[model samples]
Target: MGVTGIGGFFFRARDPEALRAWYAEHLGVGSVPYGMWETQAGPCVFSPFPATSDYFAADRPWMLNLRVDDLDDLCARLEEAGIAATRDPEWDMPGVGRFARIHDPEGNPIELWQPEQPA
Candidate 1:
């Protein structure tokens, strides 16, 4: 029983309050006062990208990938709220999942994944 799951994710924010609000309002993350994000129990990817990986911005050290259930609905909601999200056919893995990319107000890349149905 050494480590359980991810307890928290701390990062530097230029305007912490504003960023927090943006995340809560748009992505429904960290909405609680304790900074505890309620997430579904599913696969959590912990791959560290190479320094030159083009998946996200070079200046950014990390990208946040969250597993979602209804990706198309979520993307539509974001777009209705005036947030731009990009979906590409190339990002879909036959047996893995479909992915969509979006950037927060501060330009942090966020990847939303909808996994394939279990056969």
Candidate 2:
């Protein structure tokens, strides 16, 4: 048997409605208030972190990594929306791809990743 990918990533937000709208406008995510994103992708990554893990660097135990096709384009869009985009060089990999960190209006850290293709 094989494990399936992520079903949904749930996190708290001060205002779910505004956050949903932000994602809809900036990232093109059809998000709903207090609801799972209805997407067509499958076999997503559902990872559990250790209590002492510093990977996410958040007060909370988990982080959401949304895969993207074009990191540069998305970052530009986020900037155009007046959302500050933060980049951590240490989080980037040469072949794996680039990662940009950003927090939502509610202060949820979201990692946007664009993975490299296999050679």
TM-score of each: 0.92, 0.79
Error of 2 at 93 (Å): 1.6
**lDDT (Cα atoms) of all candidates against the true structure:** 0.87, 0.76
| Candidate 2 residue-pair clash tally | 3
> How well does candidate 2 score on lDDT at residue 25?
70
Can you list the residue pairs that collide in candidate 1? none
Q: Show where candidate 2 strays beyond 4 Å.
A: 32-43
Q: Please, what are the lDDT tens digits per residue for candidate 1 over residues 1-119?
A: 98767777788888888888888887788874445677777777779988989988899999998788899999999999999999999999998999999998889889999999989
RMSD over all Cα atoms, model 1 = 1.4
Worst 10 contiguous positions by lDDT, candidate 2? 34-43
